[model samples]
Target: MTESPLTIPIYDGSLVSVRSTGSSMTKAQLTTGLARRKAEPEPKWKSGELPSKYQCPSCSNYLRFPVQFEDCGHYVCSSCLPDIMRVASRCPTCQVPISKDKLVNDKTLQKDIQSLEVYCTNKDKGCDWDGTLRDFPVHFETCGFISVDCLNGCGAKFEKRFMNKHQKDDCPKRTVSCEFCKTSIIFEDEIPHLNVCTEFKIPCPNQCSTEEYPRGKMQDHLENDCTKQESPCPFNECGCEYRGHRPDIEKHMKEAPGIHLNMAGKTIALQKKLLQLYEERSNEQKNWIEILARKVNGLEKNYGAQYIWKIDHYSERLQEARSNKKTTLFSPPFSTSRHGYRLALSICLCGDGKAKGKNVSLFICICRGDYDSLLTWPFSHRVTFTLLDQCEDPDNRRHITYAVKPNVCKENRPFLGRPITDRNASFGAQKFTDLDAMSTLEYIKDDTIYIKVEIDNEEMVPI
Candidate 1:
């Protein structure tokens, strides 16, 4: 006779047969048993004690499936008999030879064991289940206190009663689709995904009349479409200070032409005044530079006692004098000796006093000198003036020359004495040369005239 497989009741009330091998259950059977029991609450013995007759002889545990040996009339738990038979082919208690055909189901012992009362293993965690062993497995499968993994594979464990709630409301791996973009994402990542959703609507931050726009189009609206944005007047650089909304500014330009014109005119006037001030300052700086250059030139010519005065823009100077813009021009100062009297030459281009309009007038002025105290008063020095000719042949050139000796008398003291001011009054020829003589000669060439002034050092009076 073939040995019968031990059968156990599962959650669905279907019987699963457990076939044993030499010393263990088959892997597939072991796995199925573990999986079924993994979903159930663990059981606890609630009855005072289990009777020894219902316990397995090999394992000493309460019998799950009791089996009898015909040869020895001995009983053992079906769960433990495979291990016992693998060691020896005999009843573990009576030493009688045993075989697969000699084993039979002990239904009487099983009935007695099933009647034992037990409590739910989760009783310590607030479960109050207490029932006969026959009902324990079924109740455990449906127990609200049983802990199980989330069905969504989110790796969270909670009571079976809360499984539905966690999967529906709180599981991080639960699939959710965005309401605006309709993109699918996990529940926990929904908020971050919405932050970049292109289709999401947002109100304009500028608080313009437009209510809202798609997030991706909001910047374009603010820059190009908003009429309520403030802008400066188109004529702002012309001194118009008006600033307003786009529509209001358009209206302002159309209504305020006279005001803008006045502003522009005033701006032009202010610029002209600033230009005039700049020119005056420039002229003053030029004068100071000329003075400094003259000082440096005087030092270079200390022992020479002669100066070549170059008059440039001859035609311009003549026209200015004729127009009364300027009448006289002075040469830079010179000295009689290295430490002697300082003097300067002056010319009236259009003539002066008795020579007016007929000839050019020339004069000499006594300028204050550093060594004046060591020189005699009523300055008596023989001075000479020469106007250069531009003729190529020096032999044929006729350079106009004139000499003068200052009269040492009280009447001419102001012109001959040591200067008490920047210079004593100029005194010299009223008609140095006629205008017609100058025009006929090479005295003026390339719009330039050169005049030479020299002090006769041999005749210079000393203290």
Candidate 2:
């Protein structure tokens, strides 16, 4: 069967077109009009079926809005009339020539067709309206079972009766007002707007006596108005330990002046004592640092078995020794090997023992070392000492040299044994070099003397 276009008014007061088939309507046909309104089922005729005379000849469907041909009294549905006139200019069944003026609306046949009783289109959907075809269109328009699109543009369809409820309560596009801020907004944006609303009331963050305040004023209230926030006492720097709410703390300050004064006095006394202790500790640390620095310097100097001692300010040292101010001057320490015995050279500028005021005294001392436990006890290495001539010409130089070997016996254990203290007692010649010999040659050139000492590694005792 051919389709017929039907125009209907929707709930939104707008007209939309829908296509109707002969007997039963489809969901697609209904939804295309933006209204899911079905067309009525076939009408119930007294004879059980529509008569053939009232059916269109071209499409074979019952004639709707039937038009009659004046020549043969033949009729076709108005929707199909245009096609017949355009194609053949004659009645489709009789072949009689027909024109637009001769084809007229058959009011009598229309009334007959309208008087046929039919069930409402929404009968399957629980609609009970049953009436003549003439009253069907009016009943369908107001049918509560018919689904229509929401007028709010929310893209929802339901019974025409529920449209009002959907728009007022469920449609996202419906207008709404914020309860707290009293601002108008669409239901779709209501949640997002409420989240950022400045006038929204929030509980006090500090948990003060005040129940709540607007979010916009919360910061100001916390900063200047909260009574439960804890603050330090006014005399906190004077060792006052009290902390309380502003009002309680103010009361404390007014009642505790004598206690605050006592606390101030004790705080000053404690500060003075702390300062004295700090000074003492600082001095001790400084001394320890100086000792560590000297040890580091000694380690740097004693990298090998040989050491070249440069004695500057020789005159001043000699004068100090002669006046009995300082008799001994110690050289930085030296090592027998990279990780072997630690030793140092000491010199008495004026002389000592039998050579007092006659010759300079020189001695060797064994110092405690990190590798002492790994070395052979009672030192046995031979040592050689040389006093550089400091001459401008190397060939013309007369350098004084001496060699010594430790006794390596129990009697010499005090001087040669593994050192128990920072350094063992000194041992060597008391009359090393005479004062007269120093005055001759270039031994004391530029008031600076260079002394070289070498520990013999050739016969070094293996650990």
Candidate 3:
């Protein structure tokens, strides 16, 4: 009903017979020239020339076949389809969405499109991909600059060609953590994530269990909801086993003699024995001084007046030494009534950490039950201590910690060690912070209670 899109041939009378462009020409002319033919027939005036076989717009293959498109007369026949559409489903000639109906059954187009060189759509955007129109759309989507993952850090790949979306986000190569906490998160965060996943719990301080949970629920788990609870008894081997809540054993130990008596402040009688030992040591020192004076006097009388006068002459010096030498004794103001629940004990001792015998001052801080009365050396002698059968692995063993040093411990430089003890010992951070409950932890590996020692630097001293 309308004019043909192509201009009519202009001719002069003098022998001018011309062949028309038929509205389509050099593929380049498909660009600028198409504008001049503004009135070209809708059915494509003389049906533009078919795609060549070499360029094979039909099958996108060199082999000729009856594939073609009605819109643009470009497509692959059913037989040539799989090879031409390798990675793309768009038409080879028209560059439209591939569909079963778009396929043309004209071998002429298959052989004709071969002569045309199709530029990939991405070529305008810097992609230099070149292929027959059939593979051009596919090539454009998979261009190297299309932003692919570098895996380790750079690069691109044909992602849509594969069923799986991608190993990574950008180009399928970066490293990423699991969005589900427990699922395998290949390279990048997944599209969506579930925070409440129970399998992906966090690491807990107790080192017991890990599970994924909300931050609020995490707090509840750490405080009280933990599924597992464990507490070991301090007495490792003596079989004075006790575990569980503090209130339970605190009441039980009050009645159990073997466990309780060994613990301090429970018995009225044991307290009395400690006071007696203090007195006995005092008496021994006094007796030794009198015996020494008597022997010196006897020697003076028997040896002769010279020796006796010599002793007599040195009597002034002897008096001075006696006056200066202070005798050591155990002393505490006697209070018949025991201090209730106060397990604090203080003591002074001469420690021998070095051969020269460095005189060092240190005090032990512990609890009443840290030491056993049955031990006799310290608990009964000092004010208080923590008792145990073993130092390590307290659940199965017994160990002890003395809150105070005994007066009689001479040159005994005790240390805080892995085994028996280490002189220059340090408690674990937890033990260090808890000054009060450290003795109870000695029920595990507690700090050491240092005893003072006396040393002589005479060996290195300059006269």
Candidate 4:
């Protein structure tokens, strides 16, 4: 987009023609217009030339609004007369004593000075303007070569041709807007203004939507104005889903007491039933885990305890299992301690995709151990599984990690001991890393790879 030029309007509207550069009159035409009516002697002086009598003795310039000395009748330009007295009380040319009181307006000389034609002071700079002294001021106003100070106060000067470019692209004083607050400020001050502008946008604290509101008014809006904000029912916990502006919701609760009480009663009843079901499921999972723990404990005593396990030649094993030719491969049972939880890792070559297996699924499971009731019912451990690369230190590691989901409530959980999730949820490549990506994983070495499970007591694994 092109920027408009900065033009100061000419005070004398008649000067508008100063902008035109085209010539309608030729030199010959102009000469004929000023020619004598009949053959006559050539004059000693041209129209614009000042006769010697009209020159200022002090300044040696064409006399303007000449002031005559009453005693000597000598004319001096009004401007030079002032300085002439400063240098000496006598007239510069005649050496006659002169003073301001003896000076009087010389109308004849003034008229002559005004009629003299002169070239514009800017003509050398490419302006072809020509006019009498009386019209010089008007022509100068619109001269293209005249320089102007920057309108934006940037301490720069520009000619008409470059004025718009400087103001639009280079002036530091130009106006700009702050990105965060949308406030207008000078270009140089934009960054600093944004740093302190209080109007920057912020999201509603109630999370009603992604739309943002101005930071300055957010608190008041959230406290008394937001519509999506929720408030407790007058009859607390009435299972009401009706949320609205604070004032409207409050009015509803007060006017609808009877309806609210009925809702409150039903909500309480449902909550109680939910608690009962949760207790029943919790007891069931506790008993089941206890049984498995006992069996695991007896087996461990017979076979030395192991806390880490490995599966070798993974690709081959997956292919075999997928053929319905033994799908489940079990890891040697392991425990963190004799009395701690007994767990095992399990894998299936045929994925549940039922495509007849193109993937692998892994799981962590609970095994019956000796310390059943005496130990923690729901195991809480951070499990990290590493698929070890056959290569050296840095290049040989790929991790598949999961935090064992606690039996928060047996009734609600998908299965026990974190149920190892589904093929899509827990250990499947689709869940941890895509199967195709796993094929390129650095950890798979030779046809064999090792898996390690470590427990971090300090980290609480999130579901």
Q: What is the C-alpha RMSD of each candidate to the true structure, in Å?
A: 35.5, 29.7, 31.6, 27.4
What does candidate 4's lDDT look like per residue over 1-463, in tens digits?
1111222111111111111112231111111111121221111123546578877776666655456776787876544554565557678778899765555555556666767677766566676777677677577777777788999889998775678788888899998778777677899987677656778777898787788877787877776667766665555556666665677787887888888888978988998999999999999999999999989755654342334566677788867775777777778767655565567777664654443344455566666666545555455555665555545666555465544444446553443343233211223232333446456766566666566666543342221
Each candidate's TM vs. the true structure?
Answer: 0.39, 0.38, 0.20, 0.31
The residue pairs found clashing in candidate 1 are none
For all candidates, the clash counts are: 0, 0, 58, 7
TM-score of 3: 0.20
> What is the Å distance of residue 262 in model 3 from its true position?
5.0
* Residue lDDT tens for model 2, 277-378: 999999999999999998975664445878889999999999999999999999998888778889999999899988989998888899999999998888
Q: Which candidate number has the best lDDT?
A: 2
Off by over 4 Å in 4: 1-53, 70-73, 99-104, 142-144, 160-165, 196-463
Against the true structure, candidate 4 has what lDDT? 0.59
- Note the Cα lDDT for every prediction shown: 0.76, 0.77, 0.36, 0.59
lDDT: worst 10-residue window of model 1: 25-34
Per-residue lDDT for 276 in model 2? 100
TM accuracy, model 1: 0.39
Better of 1 and 3 by TM-score: 1
